[model samples]
Target: MRETPVLVRPGDADALAAGRHGDPFAVLGPHPVADGAVVRCFQPQAASVELLDGDQAVAMTRVHPDGLFAVRLAAEPARYRLRVTGRDGAVVESEDPYRFPPLLGSLDVHLLVEGTHHRLYQVLGAHPRAFDGVTGVGFAVWAPNAERVSVVGDFNGWDGRRHPMRLRHEAGVWELFIPGLDHGTIYKYEILARGGVMLPLKADPCGVWAERPPKTASLVWGQPPRPWDDGEWMRGRQRRADRHAPVSIYEVHLGSWRRRPDEGNRPLSYLELADELGDYVSEMGFTHVELLPVHEHPFGGSWGYQPVGLFAPTSRYGNPDEFRAFVERLHQRGIGVIIDWVAAHFPSDPHGLHWFDGTHLYEHQDPRLGVHRDWNTLIYNFGRTEVLNYLVANALYWLEEFHVDGLRVDAVASMLYLDYSREPGDWLPNRFGGNENLEAIDFLRQMNQLVYQEHPGAMTVAEESTAWPMVSRPVHLGGLGFGYKWNMGWMHDTLDYFSKDPIHRRYHHNQLTFAQLYAYHENFVLPLSHDEVVHGKGSLLGRMPGDEWQRFANLRAYYGFMWTQPGKKLLFMGGEFGQSSEWNVDASLDWHLTQYPVHQGVQRLVADLNRIYRTEPALHQFDTDQRGFAWIDCNDRDNSVLTWIRRAIDPHDFVVVAGNFTPIAREGYRVGVPEPGFYREILNTDSEWYGGSNVHNNGGVEAEDVAWHGHAWSILLRLPPLAVSVFKRDG
Candidate 1:
């Protein structure tokens, strides 16, 4: 350990002025001194240094003429305060900043052995020395400002009087070498100031164990090994044939997915959720299950955004091993699991890790750049090296440690700008004064690079609303490198069109067509996220126009269009069953709504849609290839009808989709097709299973020939208003 004496220059008036307030050493030197060590403090501004014992002051001869005070305590356990008077007789106490009541010094230490040769010290109430028969204890703390530190916890019985901690000089750390006392001991720190003010240290930011007030330290226990058997199950399924194939997703909040009021409304456990939801997802036909944030969070209602412990799975949802088992179960059932990860901001809980070391340790201290006004949370200084590591490590932790297949990064738009949700003067501009937060951009790039390099098959999706160019592009090409992005445009446009009157829809028909024009430019996923079903906007089923029957018809037509559209899809919880009420995070999903015909019909339609998508080669095929899709007829504005054909590169495989936006059925309408062979009706939105008027064309109806180019054919068929139909050409 390197130890140097404090320096005082005669001409440095500022350094001297700083010293008069206390032991100039407190301001300029390390604290929590050890016995048999010579320590010195120099105040260039101090007129004199007088040593005091319990308010009785006595002048001490200066060891150096240059305002340097040196003293060597005769034994261990000594407490001394300094009296430094300024040139004007101004006196300051060593405990000026630390006015709180001094804690009793009874230090206790618990030695925990994490692994062979890996020992940890967990300090409990003040005591002294290592007790017999104890094996090990783990020790950690959050202190960014202390010059010297040491562990003095319950193992020592709060006694700094005996067994004082020695500072680990090189690491800016303080440690107590305990020989015995083992795990499950409470602890606190004995931090020596450069001056005389001594304080207790705080908890570790990355602590696995946490406890509430009155119960100081959490009991750290070893995690039991979990047995999972999904590796072989995942490798057996065929890879997705097409990217655009009716990729429907069921978004869920596990805690609220199922609960009964009679059962005290307790949330389902991880094992129960997997058992119940796995079957439900398979039956619903959704290709993936996108879950709300599942990481350990301090507040339940904040929706898991304000994470305190990034590594630990929320103890609220079973144990760490149980969560692993739950994820493995999902994989075994052939459903991909997507978890929400929030690296944007964190809660400012004192015990949680905001400023554990009494400095802006984990976050930026400058309020202009560090504070998130809208959330009242602490924003990470993404520019810092350690901060970047923390976030990147967290992402890897979820994917490798918990076996999560994908990550849907929440609030990415907020992470992209310096003025995100803030006004002028309320936020600080970067070096360029531009709105772009370059630090955030650099951090995002690094995070994406690390994730892709470490886990190639793992998917990273961004919830970015802004038109940030190349967000889904690979990092080598200057893109953010997300696998996919939530298609906010589609959600907004569809919601806007659905809420409008039929007469008004004529003007807004372009909103539905506009998404297709540039949809393939960036890999996109159409999402009806939780935002659409919360805060009075109502559920997706409730957003339809017209009367009760017409409303259900509108919903059915919308789903048909959504499935046929050239992109992946995600539906928030309660949407597949046509939930009538808005989502309530506090309660279970509206499972009771399944009894209603409209709701059941919606569910049946979704299930059939998934089945058709799996059977058809045209839907998901060409998900990124431009040549796989074409609009057969988009100019039928007067009839409120749109026709599109999805084809595979092989030319023999294809599916034709037609949508009629009007509210009245049109008989014997002739629509164009891509191939001239017999076109058979595959899926109709107006089927009785979907709560339609039973006007669907019978399956396997052959289409007659017509004069058209490029193997195109025209078919005259009965087209229902506000419905969609898919046809496959029989070879």
Candidate 2:
């Protein structure tokens, strides 16, 4: 018969009696171990534990009848493995599971000792004062299945023999506490399995510091308090102005935005970029600046998606301190900054947080839930409690550390589905056998909740292309709780309509007009993001179907329609000036194109769009509120004409916008107006400032009342083709 395992409490006897059999794992002691202290693996499932010196296996004594085996060696440490055998006298498992160097398949095991696991790193604990001047170094891993684990890093010369970690059990967790080693010590783990298997060393899954060469864990130095001068800015945090308010966003990729002056044309430092780009964006009248991923990534050109160090800002840009300064500067300039955050998947780089602590920690252990076959990346197992903490902590870290105003989550569609881009038999369904990845959905909801709860003024945007409803709905309504979603339908419809030849565009006009039917369901942003120009899709200018002049004309018309549409506007770099060549991150934007009138016109149009958006209150008032916009005309598709009215909540003040898509100018066209009075032209696409013919109607025109339709009073005006006109009759 098996003997009951002895349980001991560090403090109270009554507490120990109540918790004795309830908790399966318990720490033997809070052993005060040195950096290179020697320890051993203990497991109940195995017959015995043997310490293997090279090819020789030294047998360990069984200390407990419950299958606890251990060994202690005093000799200088070197490469070693642990071997386990079953009761049948057969080799049950071997340590260092990988057959080759780098130890790819090694699982990270935690040694439960004291109140903590031997391999667990602590940041803030109950004994905070113990770490006051102590500069405590914390480590974390994502292994959920390992029976035993230990850490061995540069502080121990990557030797698993000399310094093995002890795992302390706490609330179903295994941890270890090392007192001596402070900051800047590289480490990896040695794990022993209950099945008698030896695995190679692995890094921490949530490690902030990592290196590729010599195979070592990251060394994190304690950070000092961030230097911020925007105390007033912090106090002013509030919900942003309504959606219809003039909103123009400039999307930028930091690395390629501008090159470094000193490092052979490398990217600019965060400080340098803040000084230059901040002023440029602010001067351009963009309310917000959306930056690509700023998270630490091993791959530069991947657009910051394969995040390994979620808490660490990418060292490639600058130090975390410098990045904070950059954000503070943007805040000082009264411009909101939004970062592209990728929470979908991470790269499988060994030095990263993939298998740190010798187990599948961050990702799912099973192939079904943990793998991202489409991107060759590791999918995060959001169902685990530790994993939830890891991700939630990351999101909060950015908001608290960087003081960012918003985040545009990348690839949300991928996170919303279990069988996304997966073939039959290749993917696993949830318990309900549904294609929806409920775990991912729960994680997204939790992340959004935490973000909003902690940062009230912050915004969360989703780059989801699928028709997932309630993406922009409130959290209480069973939604993913994003502030806004990219209007992908508008992007596709507008691109498809504009890519056609002028003669062919007449047939495709409905593509542009039809998007309004469902536009009110959620707050949306019209985006011409980096995806449109990369990978041989060609530049926006190249998408035009006509010769030089007509191409320019078509492009201008496209911009006109985009500006008049009811949504926030975001444009990628080089797009505002009609870049002829497709964007490549390796090269700079085509600044020399300013010499051409067409390019200058595009720039002017962008500027005017910003001005128009800002000056017209009607455009922004309807952002979240439903009653701000109304379509006055939707039927005139044959002549390529559409009309809409943006009215203030007061109903007395309003603006009427009309656009004609024909190639030639039209005269004496009777267009319906909301009010009969002097309807002055506020903006015209055919103006010379926007690279068009100088055929604009002067400042104000009086509209005479005539019996046209059932309404007795109507306005007759000359409407220019491929042009946008906004009129206002304010009493």
Candidate 3:
């Protein structure tokens, strides 16, 4: 033990050494004494400490044995450096971390507190910054309720007392600039609860980089100066992203999409995935690739849906820069990238936002408003400006930082309603006694408006399953302001209709027609998403009714019908090749299943469907307009046959689609045509190339001038068994 100096109080020295001081800034940095100015430092590993001013040394007295050193200066110096001698006499020099001014500006803090700051990520989190020629990491976090917050990491032996941050009282934000620290420094904030109870070390909520979990340390990083090459793509994306354009999305779960067995079945890295996935999607003619949640989460089973770090991209694939390269590569291939974004709820991880600062700072105090009963997660307190700013800034961070093309906002239905997935009397009503989450509604509209305003051509899509009005309409029009909504009703009804046996299919024929009643209500995406093929629901192929041959034919016909229908398209990874098993997060998708011809045929048919959907203006040019679709015959339920004409803006440019859901072929079936001209059989699902029994359509059919089904001309058609046929009228 070292002798306690008469000048140093026992209580102050003990608190500094013990690392529980609420205000380390008051004692450790330059302070005015009656004599002039005095500087104090607690260097626990130093045997002796010397203060240097322009080559002159003012030896510091060892006030306490635990390495507390103090020096009374005759005059305050402009700057000072500490020369520290280790226990083994190894001498080193460094600028003191405690002497720097606050790194954050007052305006930033004021905006942050008001919750109007859309760019909180620019200020909060650990950033490697150079200030006044001293390189170090600048740290900031909002923990207004904490008694003390310290920057703790490998540098200080994880000691909190060594670097307690300066609190900005008005904003409840704590900030510190530690000199000499650089990028790659792993760190966490040590926060003391208001009542003085020390809580668990918490990860930075706005951190840009993080250790791949089960490790929760936030890594200090600086934004690299990488040049973006997607300028043309960005400028022209609006034309391609609108409702009138072709938007065929190939949904992917990167981890399970493909794995290398030689590398212990590990998923591909970001670069590898960029090359492989980009080529595959481009070859299949998909306009965009939508990845499942890529935010950082601890559990691999959640597939990133229950995220803890909203700003950090999961290190499972790559770092932030690497993810940026992946997006650039996809853009080069004319493929847009959309990530699933979860703002509805978050998991109750100990190191996460749950009970942050020993209070419900990010969530609501009431369980009815804060907790999600079904997921066991915590709902965000959207009413709080800071909480709303955090989520909104997170959205902008991904879009601006990563050049992400879109965000598929997940579980939007849950966010829109207060009583989602809750029992009666288990949820809180809004101020108006309604079930609507008013604060959440405001947050969503604001987020969507900001995303579109800041990043042109970038879209915000909603995974909304309910009949929420105007989901895809503009905010100025009293809407949620999403670019598109997933057409869950169409998917459910279509799948249900296809699952029935042919003999009983006539009884359920209305299931196929019911979706048309509300199909045009919103700009929808007809999705065969991963949700339909997971958790014992089985693969799309497995749900089809029949023998192997019928199952393949049924799936091909369904794809053909979905493509020709009036909506944008989305299909999950395995559905294209017909993976037999349900989706398993840990296991690789059955890529081996494509070896069979039936699976190969399904993929080939999908490719053809995309080709047709892209080139045929009638199929994609007016996907959201009622004029694009006109039923020629929908009441033929006795034979389970349906026919419709899909038209473009110029009604003359149209394609007629007919589907036969039974195993029996219809020979010489009369179908009406709008024009007295030759109807070319552009595509037939029963074609020999697609693993079907060779059926005859001959090349085309000439329409006779006989009025039928409200049309002036009609054609005799041979509809193949369990197949879909498409025809175009030649000029």
* Candidate closest to the true structure, highest TM-score: 3
Model 2 spans with C-alpha error above 4 angstroms: 1-166, 171-204, 208-217, 241-246, 260-263, 624-626, 707-712
lDDT of 2 by residue, 600-685 (tens): 88888877777777777776666445577766676777677777777765786777777877677777767666567787787877
Off by over 4 Å in 3: 1-10
lDDT of 1 by residue, 112-221 (tens): 11111111122311223322322344343424355444444564455433223333233323343343444445554544444445543444444444443333333343
TM-score of 2: 0.78
Off by over 4 Å in 1: 1-137, 147-204, 209-221, 233-247, 708-711
Assess the local accuracy of residue 269 in candidate 2 as a C-alpha lDDT between 0 and 100: 80
Better of 2 and 3 by lDDT: 3
Q: What's the distance in Å from true for residue 17, model 2?
A: 37
Against the true structure, whose lDDT is highest? Answer: 3
lDDT per residue as tens, model 3, 1-731: 33234346678888778766777777886777676788888889999999988989888988878988988887676789999999999998998877888878988988997888888998999888888888888999999888889999998889887788988888989999999888899899999897778888999999888998899988987756599988877878888888889999999998999999888999988999999999999999999999999998988888889999999989999888888999999999999999999999999998889888889999999999999888899999999989999999999988988989999999999999999998999998999999999999999999999999988788888999999999999999999999999999999999999988998989988888888898888899999999999889999999999999999999988998899999999999999988888999887889998899888999888999999999999999889888899899999999999999999878799999899999999999999989988899999998888888867589789999888889999999999999999999998
Enumerate clash totals for all models, in the order shown: 67, 46, 0
